[model samples]
Target chain A: MKKINFSAGPAILPASVLTQAAAAVENLDGSGLSILEISHRSDAFDAVLVEAEQLVRELLNVGDEYGVLFLSGGASTQFFFTAMNLLNPEETAGYLDTGSWSAKAIKEAKNFGKVNIIASSKESNYDHIPRGYTVPDGLKYVHLTSNNTIFGTQFKEWPETDAPLVADMSSDIFSRRIPLEKFGIIYAGAQKNLGPAGATLVIVRKDLLGKVNRTLPSMLDYRVHIDGGSTYNTPPVYPIYVMMLTLRWIKAQGGLEGMEKHNERKAKLLYEEIDRNPKFRGTVADDFSRSQMNVTFVCTDEADTAAFQAAAEAAGCDGITGHRSVGGFRASIYNSMPYEGVETLVRVMREFE
Target chain B: MKKINFSAGPAILPASVLTQAAAAVENLDGSGLSILEISHRSDAFDAVLVEAEQLVRELLNVGDEYGVLFLSGGASTQFFFTAMNLLNPEETAGYLDTGSWSAKAIKEAKNFGKVNIIASSKESNYDHIPRGYTVPDGLKYVHLTSNNTIFGTQFKEWPETDAPLVADMSSDIFSRRIPLEKFGIIYAGAQKNLGPAGATLVIVRKDLLGKVNRTLPSMLDYRVHIDGGSTYNTPPVYPIYVMMLTLRWIKAQGGLEGMEKHNERKAKLLYEEIDRNPKFRGTVADDFSRSQMNVTFVCTDEADTAAFQAAAEAAGCDGITGHRSVGGFRASIYNSMPYEGVETLVRVMREFE
Candidate 1:
């Protein structure tokens, strides 16, 4: 049976991409060498790095002022790296504590400089995006988790701020179109909508670097990677190659606009079933703030939760269980989750009801 | 024609491992989902992580006193991380300047603490490992690059020092056994003898941590990864899986002892040919210091270099070209490069002569 994977991360990639990647693993483009054995400095891998960067730019409409870097150590590393490069000891950066990821980012940023919490929805268990928070001037940058995978809340609108906006878009990077000009830095782990778990996609405004007074580690510094073209050392070659394949798949899907429509349709189908089915109810406090990527919901009667889970598993639905902290269900309909997969889940919910 | 790959770091892996890894990329052990799509927290992946750690402990004879961690950002990140976690700003560490990599490691260590160059071969262009340096008491640790990939030299004997030995064993780990008791920490990027380019294998003594006074970034701090079981933040999933597969292959081939004998035989075959063929001459000054993993040599006549390269290419021998700095040839016959592959390279060298 073909399992419907709703894994929050290290999530579903396009089937075609997986097939091609598998083939490349054995013999890359009939070059008689496995992709795993290729050197990062070789012309073949240089092409991969260049094409991946170009695809990111074309798909995201990234400007020339920004440098697209495919780096190792996921978004978790970027949490502190962003601050380390841009935030000085005397400067302060504003962060919105919307969910667990944002909170962790705040914790790391505080190590480098002063981190001011602009607003927080933590009191409500991060059930919605915090609103009406005044953005203070003189901040180094305003940071936020654009999409929270844990609580299933996403920022529907940009927070009004003059400081360069830094966002961790790990779960929903390619799912929708964004205002590229508004972001000074946008970093995402490749597992969610991109490709796999090893590579991190970082888009940074080149002008935003070199202001910090502290000495930066070569690997941690964005300038070093940008200058080296993301090959300062041996990069995650396999992951970057897989990402390139995923990017090609995205381009075939008519770029981000097509992905937005596809993802929105899937989210609408699943959310409607959650609302209509008597056994279920959505978890987020506000419908407007609910994530279009990870749709979290729960059974109205706690007893039905276990029954529904068993049925879903039997029906070949995998990874629908919510995080341990949330304890319900999270159907992560990322860019590659076909509409039919969501339809299958809705059918299961309807049957349970 | 199947090429004999000798690329250094991001080098060749066992053929069977490549086939199995390729199969897993599409569907991991009939799980009905691609390995690239599985969650790291899933039981399937948990088994992989556990087994990989066990293999390391068994093969390396790692005791419970140390932590076996799989991290991201490669060994380049560890150049600074080791110093940040072990060396304080006021303390000093000894570093043996052997090759380009060791030079870089020394440069990064200088950022965190006082560095003493105990011995250096930089004046000799790193053609040999410096020796006879007396170790001073009270130094934090003595750092060395076990195998100098760029210059084709290796340390045959460890220095006498009370301080813990921190080795950057990026090029030759898993190819041979070592006295694990002498080293406080051993880190290697999984691009050479291990697996691919993303995951970094770090074995650190538990007591060595928490000695540094500086507040560490969670990502750079080894303790964070150790405590998190190396899943601190979505580890390079595919890379770790590939490494696990490679580890399994290593075990099947008689563990470290079997690997050492196999590697030694391959090195001997190629080195014997290089010494016999009047067209070639070994680059390392000391015969005992010549690396068994990477056999570097040059054409006796400079003009014959391009001719040998063309002949090697025509015969389907890949990655034999040496580093541009050295400007000769580097036949990196890592553990995975079968005896037959080295035989083919030897044939090419003989034909060139």
Candidate 2:
């Protein structure tokens, strides 16, 4: 069977991207060498880095003031490095606790500086994005997560803050148009919409750096990577190459505007079935806060869970099982997720009902 | 013509391993999903992680007292994380300054505790490993680099110390048998002999941890990785998978003992040519300190450098040009570097003469 993939992150990639990446793993750009064996400083990889960075700027309409870094360590490490580079020991950083990832970022930030919880949806079980949180003055930066993969909520609107905005857009980056001027730093782990698992993409406005009062470790310093052009250490060459191919795929699919339309259509189709079908119910309370990337819901009858899963499996739906923390179903419809896959799941839901 | 790769770390991989890795990128073990798309928590990846860790234990003869972690951010990150987890603020850690990587390690260690330089070869321009330095008592741990990639020197013998020994074996790991009991921690970035870039192999004795006074960041803490089985977050999935394949290949080639014999042969052949050829001379002064991984030399006439490079290129030799810091030639013959490739370079050198 041709499985319709719905993995949350390290999720589905475009078929063509996979084909090209597989070929590159054997021989990159006709060099008679695998991309796996090429030096990070090689001209071929340098060209890959250039094109990847260029695509980030062009797709997001970013200005020259921003620097795009392809760094190792997933967003989990960024939970620390972001604060280590941006927040001084004395200054306060505001973090909105939306879900698990935001909470992790808050914990790591506290080790560096004073972290204030501007707002948290934890009391409500994070089914919706917290709103009306006042952004206090004299803060180093305000951190927010654009999409919560686990809780199935997203920030539909950016919080108004005078402090420079720093967002972990791990799940929804490149899926929709991002306003580049409003943030100090926008970072994402590359597995979701970017490419694969090893590389994290950090897009920071150059002016926001060099302001932190601590003497940073050389590898932890954003300025070092920006200066070295993301080749500070041997980079994750294969992941970065795959990322470049992904961005190229995104551009061919009509950039973020076209991606937004595709994602919304999939989300709408799946969500409508959840609302209409008696056997299924949407997990998130607020419609506006529901994520377009991850659609979370549950079987109406707990006893029918097994049967529903079997039906979905028989229909070639893969990774529809919900996160372990949340006992239900989640169909992650990222940029590369075809409309047909969502339709297939909707049919499963209807037939199961 | 098929080119021979001689690039330093991020060097060549075995052809059979490359074939399997390429196929895995398309569909890992017939999962009908690209390895790039599978979740790190999936059964297939869990099996991969288990097998990879098992292979490391089997090949290195690591006891149960040690923990194997596949980490990210490369060895550059470990240069700091090792100190953060093992060194206390008041105590001193002894560092052996071997070359660029060792110097970088020392600089990062100073941030956490007092760093003492017990031995240094920087005075000799790192042409040979420094000996006769006392391993003073009451030190937190003694640190050294096993192989100097840039300077072409290596530790022919380890310095005796009562304190736990930590070695950065980034360039020489798995190419030879290691005495697991002599060291508290052994770390290597997986680009040279291990696999590709993106993953770092860290093997640490469990007892050596939990003694540091500082409250380390969770991700930086070695204990966290050990407890979580190196899946603290989504690991570099593809890199780890490839490392497993590389280790499997190593086992097929008769493990570390066989690898050591092969590496010794390649190094002996190239070094002999550098010594005998009228047109070429070795860079390192001490014969005993020369590395088996990287063989560096220079043309006798400085004017012949460009022509020698062109000739090597014409003969299907790639990345023979030396690092820019030291203007000469470096032929990095890693584990997967075939004996035939080394012979080809020797033939090129003789013809050029």
Leading candidate by TM-score: 1
Best-fitting candidate, scored by DockQ: 1
Best by lDDT: 1
lDDT of 2 by residue, B1-353 (tens): 65799999799999999999999998888888999999999899999999999999999999899999999888898898899898888989999998999999999999999999998988888888887889989998899999999988888788888888899999999888877788999999999989999999999999989998766778889999999999888899999999999999999999999999999999999999999999999988789899999888999998999999999989888998888756699999999999999999999999988
Candidate 2 per-residue C-alpha lDDT over A1-353 given as tens digits, one digit per residue, 9 for 90 to 100: 55889989889999999999999998887888899999998889999999999999999998889889999888888898889888888889999999999999999999999999999999888889987778888888899999999989988889887788899999999999877788999989999998989999999988888988776788889899999999989889889999999999999999999999999898999999999999889889899899999999988888989899999999989998988767789999999999999999898888887
Candidate 1 segments exceeding 4 Å error: none
Looking at model 1 chain A, report the run of 10 residues with the lowest lDDT sum. Answer: A344-353
Model 2: residues >4 Å from true position, as ranges? Answer: none
Each model's chain A TM-score: 0.99, 0.98
TM-score between model 1 and native = 0.99
Q: After superposition, how far is residue B318 of candidate 2 from its true place, in Å?
A: 0.6
Query: TM-score (chain B) for model 1?
Result: 0.99
**Position A211, candidate 2: lDDT:** 81
lDDT measured at residue A340 in model 1 versus the true structure, 0 to 100: 90
